[model samples]
Target chain A: MIGFETLLRWLDLAGIAVFAASGALVASRKQLDLVGFMLIAAVTGFGGGTVRDLLMGRTPVFWLRDPALLAVASAVGVLVFFTAHRIENRFRALLWADAVGLALYAVLGAEIALVGGVAPWAAVLLGVATATFGGVLRDVVCNEIPLLLRKEVYALAALAGAAAFVLLRMHGIWRDTALLAGMALCLAIRAAAIARGWSLPAYAARRD
Target chain B: MIGFETLLRWLDLAGIAVFAASGALVASRKQLDLVGFMLIAAVTGFGGGTVRDLLMGRTPVFWLRDPALLAVASAVGVLVFFTAHRIENRFRALLWADAVGLALYAVLGAEIALVGGVAPWAAVLLGVATATFGGVLRDVVCNEIPLLLRKEVYALAALAGAAAFVLLRMHGIWRDTALLAGMALCLAIRAAAIARGWSLPAYAARRD
Candidate 1:
């Protein structure tokens, strides 16, 4: 049986791989070379967690401390570079994988912040940031409008998950149960958004 | 008489203001709202230093410790919001001001990294990252290509300044002298790039 911490680490790595594949697919769409694919992939995989750690004063960053994460990201990059052309609907593939990564990272981020002794509200904010910032960075670097700023319910979904995790832990729920529930909530929201075109309304100025 | 640290702080504030202004101008061009202007400005003003501090394990981040910096950035955002349309050439104005901020930040970043006891090479890298990353963040968030990744002398100019600063300090040069010389070299290169169109060659794959 895996220790709780070990299980969490595996989830984190799975999230990283899916996010990295999405990044590499974006690089392929942009006609970038292998190095570009790897660079974008690695950043996408680690970028959110890196930002979360930095804001929370965690030094050396998670990836710098653990080389295996980078190796996985780079391997995914290479694999995607060679095979992305074969995919019929790369964008759809990216969105679904991204949704999974988003859900996992949101719960993980909130849990980490909770463990770090941040306030529950701040933890939830960090969770949402952690879940979405990598994709934001990926889109930004690729010169696309970030999905976060889009009308899509991406960040709202992350926020719901993070907030749910925080609230559950506050209510003395089991940690594992809270984590699973948080991810499920996030994934369900995101999956529905993708399938049904659910989105938050765009900002509208009040007319006098 | 002002202390050296005080002088550096003033320079840092000045750099923040210029960068913030550039960010606000971009926001104006993008037709973002007031909140968007302020958010972009604040991030642009502090993003580079924030990243540098995070990488170096500097806790709380520089801006979080100094609310004055945030206030200044916000003020600049508001100012630019009202006045940007009056400017004849906002792009040219941004370039010049950005060049100044880039030069100052390159030296300051290198100095701080050295003081923090990082290796010279790492310090140089941090310096360049610090000098240009705010603009990169600004461009990225604005949905444009970052100047750093372009076929230009931007990061190269920062690299020269940071390298010169480190080399000068290694030879026991006076801190003031080294700082000024580094800034001068960086500004000169950046100015020439803007005025004379100096640029690095774009990457080209070899033909078989």
Candidate 2:
């Protein structure tokens, strides 16, 4: 049987690939050059984890320490650049892949923060940030309004997953079980929101 | 005689206040709420430094270490919120203030990286990133294209400043002399750009 660390590592790479692919698809839609595709892909893949590590005071960041992650993200970007046009429903495909990546990153982020011995609330916040911030960077760079700042359930889903993981860890649940469960909860909420057009109430600005 | 560190600290606070005021003015233009003003102001004030420290492996970040920074930024945001509409040319005011902040931050950022023993080339890049990234964050959050990515000489000015500072230091110039010279160079370039509409050559997308 594979150890928990091995499983988590594999999932982390998978998450990075999916996120990178999403970024490349955006670049394709924008008609950016190859360099733009690769840069956006790499940044979207590792941006969240980089932000998380920085906030937690982790040195050198994850990508700087492991070149493999950059290689994987860049390769995925290239592949997506060629194939994105072939897909008829590129936006839908990107959304589903993004949801999967979101769930994976959210849980993994929480676990990393917890292991770092940060406070539970801060860990949960960091996890949500890690899962969602990469996409924010992607959209911002592409000159689009980030989905997170919209009324969408994107950040809410990540928050739920990270919060669930934190609560489970506090109750002494098995680590692997909690991880899987958190991801499942996050994905389910995101999937439902995507399917049913769910969104939080729009902010009503009050003028004094 | 005033010490160098004290001078740097006062200038740093002034830069933060100016950046924060810029953000608050943007929030005013967008008609966002008071909370939005404060949040955007604080984020714009510290975002670049936060990014620089993260890249340099500086833990806990500067604003976290000194809550006074946050207080100053927030206070500037509040002040701007109440006074922005009275200004005849708010956008022009913001531009000039941002130019001053950009020069100050670029020189300080390069100095910080060099003092931290970062390689000179990387130090130059970080300084440019430090000076311009907060404005990028501010624009992106406001759903506008960042001025840094446009054809303007914004980043180029910071680059010139940072590179000049590094070169001066390498030539054994006094620290204070190098700092002032760098800022002067950056500000002169930026003012010329603003007055004469100077910009880099536009990218021509090649069809393969």
- Backbone collisions counted per model: 0, 0
Tens digit of per-residue lDDT, candidate 2, span A42-71: 989998998888887986788999988999
lDDT of 2 by residue, B68-141 (tens): 78789989877776666664255776688788999999999999999999999999998998898888888878
lDDT of 1 by residue, A26-126 (tens): 89889999999999999889889988888888766788888899999999999998888775366787788789899999999989888987667778867
Model 2 is docked with a DockQ of 0.17
**lDDT for each residue of candidate 1 in B116-182, tens digit (9 for 90 to 100):** 9999999999999898889888887988888579846998999999999999999999989999999
Fraction of true inter-chain Cα contacts (below 8 Å) kept per model? 0.25, 0.26
- Model 1's CAPRI class is incorrect
Go through the candidates in order and give each one's DockQ: 0.15, 0.17
Off by over 4 Å in 2: A1-4, A88-90, A201-208, B1-42, B62-136, B143-208
